[model samples]
Target: MPNLLIIEDEAAIRRVLSKILKEEDESYQVDEAADGVEGVKKIKANDYDLVLCDIKMPKMDGVEVLQEIQKLKPEIPVIMISGHGDIETAVDTMKKGAFDYIAKPPDLNRLLNTVRIALDRKELITENKRLKRKVSKNYQMIGESEAMTKVKDMIEKVAPTEARVLITGENGTGKELVAHWLHQKSERAKKPIIEVNCAAIPSELIESELFGHVKGAFTSANKDRAGKFEAANGGTIFLDEIGDMSLSAQAKVLRALQENKIQRVGSDKDIKVDVRVLAATNKNLKQEIADKNFREDLYHRLAVILIEVPALNDRREDIPLLITHFAEKIAKEQGTQVCTFTNKAIKLLQNYNWTGNIRELRNVVERLLILGGKEIDDKTVTQFSGK
Candidate 1:
């Protein structure tokens, strides 16, 4: 049941509001307060979906009550009830954070409609907060090692800025995970983060992939399409495996970074884009630049805030935690009971080389969970981990 509070000095008006709300929906549990002081006490004692407060109350005014609510429980939506003389005060209350204002002798239709809308808005806000929590958990960085702590510190410091980020790490070292964290934590968290793997797309088609092509730009261009850069406008674009991008595509990426503009493949018209570019590469970009395989200028542009993800082998202390995390995750995915790793098994597994990093660790954990007993032991680790 949705809880509602009516704070009004007028006993007659308070009764009317409560009656109307209960009549509209019997499920609504309405509470009444004779003055702002009583209202603030009730607000602090119980959670309310919506608050209907009178703007002109004696002892303590509605505006003052709203201010207190804003300090105490800002999430609760407050609707100010105003008389003909208090309309201006009601408007000012809204500026101070009241959800909406209801005029004197509240219109039946308007009052009910506003109440429903306020409740709906509150529901949407609650749902959004829940979803954000789920997303944060999904992208959580799971290590307490010194190397991992440094990465987390860097993310906190750099995520709020508009500077470009270049994540460097070997294959399967969770470079993409770092990119996701940066985008998720940044000011652009609400905006989309389009990811494009440079090595996955063919060299000939890489340009068209990054910067859209006209309808008749090429033989395969049957329709006009927007590219990754345009798609990521007002957001972020993660260029994974950037070292493998063709020189032609590299030049366009450089131009885009330089001018915040891009020309679609085979199109002379320049299209402007407002995007944060985040690139990742496993290969040594400096060496690539030395060999003339990568553009030094582009490297400079993308490396404004470089984050190097440490290899899993270097952070061996995190192996035990990683094993538990992966075991629980895989069990949930497979709808099976979570398997456990003994201390001996974990120590033995940590002693082995983690050439593939976290990705490799997760795979090995999954294999052991499937092939070993519920309590994975040292013998089971030796059999399934292939260490």
Candidate 2:
């Protein structure tokens, strides 16, 4: 059943429209608003599927009401009613975001059909969002290496509880991938996963970015905004490249972990968050701690369950399997036939030092697929790999 609002100033027309809509479908719960001002007020106060608004009214015009509706409740579809003389104004309303136009003394069939189409479109939008969330929920850990297998086992054992996970690995070793798998497999997966790339955000803004700020708190802070911790209230937050976080930010992070609360920048009131933190780093944190680059207390707090990802070279035995997997995936992505790699070519690739790790391997595979002939062999590897 769809909830509908009728914002026609004419009492007789409102009654007639309401009777027609209800007669067409008894399940539709319709309400009447006397004018555009009242219509905008109702929209802000409640959620509705469709709104039927008149083109002219006292205090606020239909176009102004439509703009306000879009600003506050953009998802609700609005069908504007215009008299024959108001056709130009109704077209102008469409440019301002009105869904569709209905002539004054609406044609019963046309009005009902338009309402049905708008309702169906809204349903489809909601369904598509739901399917997208389901797809994101299915972000499984993908790898066949023994290292990855062990990591998956660890995630299974640790996900049921609220222990902090510290994922350590070299650059391009899929540390972020492990973090995602941990959150998706954990009990908190149903909750939101707010991500914070400590290195990507500027150090000066990191504090406000994580803890939020009150209106007029800073030079550019125009309004009160919720921080990362507040946004991830009931779920997990993956802090990528945490080792690069500023010393001051690290102090705040340690306090949040210790107290389960965070105080916004330039504010004293602490906000509690039920967020499970998953931190990842490519640097040796122990060394960073020694150099005064990282906090030792935060280190112990985050490293409760350290899951180190082995570099590609450390797991040479998995190279053939990873190569074949990447080859098939790349072929499908490129819409080309999968090329066959000789045993010797695979062996040569396995022996090479993959300084950039698995990411580099995938790039090489793509290069070979694009540049090498139908069969990728040792000669192609020797030429492309600069061996």
Candidate 3:
């Protein structure tokens, strides 16, 4: 529900504003205050989505009320209610962070439009905050083991540069996490980071997917569309599993890296893209090159800075920390209490062969939280962990 506050000293004006607002939208939970003092009190007590304050009120005025709101709850947008001669004050209020002002006897269209736009902006701001929190959690680097520390140090050093990075690791070793950390810490952090899993996408359509295609370029190319390179312009593009990319697509990628330009499938015209490419692969590119399945020149272009993520087995000392992290993460996602494990249980889990790496550890931890006792024990790990 949209909770609104109407703070006017005059009883007649308050009633009019309330009537106009409630009739406009019944879902509006409108609250009333007799003066600016009462309005500030109400605002301090409850969370209001929007506040409508009169400029010339007894006790405190709207300007002072707005200043107080700016200090108290700046997120709650305030709209000044101006008298006929208070246009200058109304304009001035906007410069100080007021959302907008409505003249006395508010116009139905203007008042409603301003409120709607303000609410929409508030929703966007709220959503962006939530996304930022989520992103931080998702990209968090969680381990202090020597091997993990080295990787963290590399990210801190390499993320500031515009170098092409090749992240080599086995499946489930969290290669994409390194890619995300790089983008988050780089100068182009404000821009988008577009990711494409080369192995997941078929070889036949890889070219079209990377460089786009015009209408009638292929049976499914019904409309002109931009590709990943174009979308990642002035930002970063993460090519996951690049060793699986087709030989022909590798040629175009080589050209893009060499000339900073690419031609869409079935289009001879070259489109320039200022994109920093980050690639990852589980397979050995050298072996692939000898097999005549990968391009050596493209490998050289992408391997300017190579980051080899260690397997979970190599960093077994970090298992306890990872388990605790996963338990809390799972609790937050599932809206439950964080589950704890006994030291014996932790030892048992850490001894297991972690061929599937950190990704597999998280899954096992989630399973334990779901099925194990409140305080998980060694026996619980034995019974529930399918290891």
lDDT of each: 0.89, 0.86, 0.89
Off by over 4 Å in 3: 1-134
Relative to the true structure, candidate 1 reaches a TM of 0.66
**Residue 316 shift from truth in candidate 2, angstroms:** 1.1
Clashing pairs in 3: none
For residues 170-240, what per-residue lDDT tens digits would candidate 1 score against the true structure? Answer: 89888888888988988989866778999999999999989988767999885456787876777789999
Q: What is the C-alpha lDDT profile of model 2 across 122-215, one tens digit per residue?
A: 6645644464385385444556778778988998898888999999999888787787777777887776677799999999999998888766
- Where is model 1 more than 4 Å wrong at Cα? 1-138
In candidate 2, how many Å is residue 137 off?
9.0
Candidate 2 regions with alpha-carbon error over 4 angstroms: 1-142
In order of TM-score, best first, we have: 3, 2, 1
Show the lowest summed lDDT stretch of 10 residues, model 3. Answer: 123-132
When summed lDDT is taken over every stretch of 10 residues in candidate 2, the lowest stretch is: 123-132
